[model samples]
Target: MGAAVAAQAKQGGAEVLWCPEGRSTETRKRAIAAGFSEVSDIAEMARRCDVIMAICPPANAESVAGLVSAEGFRGIYVDANAVSPATMASIKAFAFRDADLLVDGSVVGSPPSTSKTTRLYLSGSGEAVAVVAGLFSGTAVDARILNGGIGKASALKLSYSSYQKASRVLAAVAHGLARDWGVQDELIDIAGGRSTSYLAEPTYIPKVAARAWRWAPEMREAAAAVGELGFPDELAEATAAVMERWAEAKDQSLGISEALELLRTDGPQTAPGPSAE
Candidate 1:
């Protein structure tokens, strides 16, 4: 995702800089391919760039904010990670002593490549938000300014992803149950006849599994968001658990049926009760 954004921004005449301090070889290769200059130091990149965009997993958002803050960066800081509103607020407080320096941002949809498929929703002081939006003006990234202040954009993102990821998990679980009941074929046939397809596709499990590890933290963040809004968070918690179960197969990309078989055979098992009670 970072590579995609960097590539687009660079293509649009922006000088993209990336810190390759602790990143993997593959990550470094991608960043270089995306036309990003390696800064080799976070503080240097922070000092050089006018606006610092933090696009990372929800779990690392706070740490990234701290890293930038420690560098004495007082420039425009955009937090585009999938985190709860409260977390966003904490990051804003941690990174920028002045609230005006933080532009709360959320990226919805896939990474921008050759097409304008991603929308970056930003909310904060109007001037700061506008400045951040201007950075991606000619790029493939579509930056939109939200009316609400900091945390609103993050709230919208978490709310949207909660349903998106949870529904995918629900579809997978439904297929698993049908397969266990010996009616998988019938379920698919029924789904085919419906307006909205009910059957999970062959690629569904594999596609989701490949990113399940990343989704786990997002799911946890979504759970926290829902809980804060006085909603039952068990659904999101269960979805996170399911994603964690498939984390081992993230790179395997097994088919839906194969993934289900693996889950039934070698995944987490229920404890046995006393024999016949």
Candidate 2:
């Protein structure tokens, strides 16, 4: 995702710089392929860039912001991670105290490889948000400013992903239960004859497992967001557990049937939930 964003920004006539201090070899390769110049240090990159966009895992959003803040960065800070509104507020309050402007940003849809497919939502001071949106102008990314203060875009992202990911979990649970009851075929037939085509097969299981490690934190964030809105967050919290179990199968190259078998036999063990603070 960072590579895609850098590629678009570079194509749109921006000099993209990245700090690949402890990133993997694959990340370095992708960053280079995206035409991003590697700065030796984060502080140097922070000093050179007009806008510092942190596109990372939800768990590291606050730390990334803190790193830039420690560098005494005063440019526009764009937090483009999947985090809850409360986390965003905390980041704004502490990690971005020195930032000239804080742009609460959230990315919805896949990475922007083609035009008009992915949307980058921004909410904050209107002028700062507009400036951040302008960086993606004439590029493949579709950037838009949401109406509200900081955390609005993050709230939207958490709410949307809560339903999107939890529904996938529900599908997996239903399929697993049907298979356990020795009525898998009947369940599939019923689902296939209905309006939902994707649920007919357990294909989404492996697909979700392939990225479950990443989705685990996202589900936890969604749980916190739902709890903040005065709703029971157990569904999302349970989904996070499901995702953690699947994380072990990420590299197993399991097919739909195999994934279902794994889920049924090796379900998630009791584990502590991710920290939203």
Candidate 3:
């Protein structure tokens, strides 16, 4: 995502500077090779850059924000990471440590790149929204500045993730059932014809399965939020349960390969092939 963001900015004639954590990582390597000036520390990046876009995982986003605050870096701080509303609120509290304008943001779909399609959902102070939108203006990204406070943007993300997670659970569970009943492929064909699974299967299942471990906790969080809000969370709960199960099977629990193998309806001899003569 950081690479995509940097590429987008560079494409729009902006000089890209990077300050990635640790000595070496994929992003840091790519940034250096891409001719971006790499800053030695977060404090330096915060002091120099007009915007500090936090693109880390939700679990670590707030910590990074706190680091920025500790550095006394002042600028527009954009949280573009996926996190719960409560988590966002906590991060917001830490972000205001240095009196910086904190803008809550959620990147819907994928990052801005040649082959990716997604929207940037921004919500915060009106002026901060404008500033964020302006930064992305003329870029290929579809930036939508929603009207709400800090947590609103993350709420949108949670809602969307819930829907996606539910669909994934249904696919894997149904696929498993069909295999057990000895009618897996046939059922898959029939179901695909009449459901969104047909389209989503090729689009999201593989992606989700690969990183299922990282997402199970977030799905559980969403389920709890739904219950707390007095909404019917049967789907979310079911999804979370399925994900948790997938996250704990075999030594390779929470891995994509394991889930893919577990969910496979077609055996080695039954998989698609050329017709017999």
Candidate 4:
């Protein structure tokens, strides 16, 4: 995602910089491939860049923001991680003390590519939001500005992802249950008759298994979002728990049965037992 955004900004004469120190080999390779000018560390990157974007897992968003804040980064800070609005709000504790502007951002869709484009939802001060939007102008990333202030983009991202992520996980569970009954194929056939049945897709379970690790934390963040809005968070919580069962198969090249084999029947009971009075 960082590579995609940097490449796009460079199309408009933006000089992209990356710090390779302490980065993983895969990350360093990608940075080199993207041709980013190397900086020594976060402090140097902070001093040299006009805008710094944080594209990371929800769990690391606050910490990453702190690193930049500690550097006294006086530029635009775009937080585009999947996190709850509350998490985002708390980051402002350290994010905006020295930073000129901290923009809440969320990405929707696949990475911007020739065949498929993605949306970058941004919300914050109008001026800062517009600047971030212009950075991707005429690029594959469609940066849309939201009217609300900080945390709005995060809220929207979690709200949309909660349904999309949790529904797919639930669909995979449904398929698992059907398989146990020797009716999985029949279930797929039943779903095939419906135009809106994404669950009907044959590759859904494998796809979930490969990405379960990454999605698990995001689903927990989604649950936080749901709970913040006074909603029952059990669905999001269950989705995270289910995804964790497939954590071992993350990004592995495996057949469907191999992926599904890790899912155990020892999960919490589906229905509550009678309470002792």
Worst lDDT run of 10 residues, candidate 1, spans: 268-277
TM-score rank, highest first?
4, 1, 2, 3
Report the candidate with higher TM-score, 2 versus 4.
4
**Cα lDDT, all candidates:** 0.79, 0.80, 0.69, 0.80
Clashes of each: 0, 0, 0, 0
- Would you list the clashing residue pairs of candidate 1? none
Model 2 segments beyond 4 Å from truth? 98-100, 193-277
Alpha-carbon lDDT of model 3:
0.69
For each candidate in turn, the TM-score is: 0.69, 0.68, 0.67, 0.70
Q: Please, what are the lDDT tens digits per residue for candidate 1 over residues 138-229?
A: 77889899886887788889878887887776566556656666888998898788674323344666777778889999989867765665
Weakest 10 consecutive residues, lDDT, candidate 3? 268-277
On TM-score, the stronger of 2 and 3 is 2
lDDT of 2 by residue, 178-251 (tens): 56568889988987776754445567778877788898999898677656655567877887887787767765
TM-score of 4: 0.70
Question: Which candidate gets the maximum TM-score versus the true structure?
Answer: 4
lDDT of 4 by residue, 86-111 (tens): 78778876577432388889998887
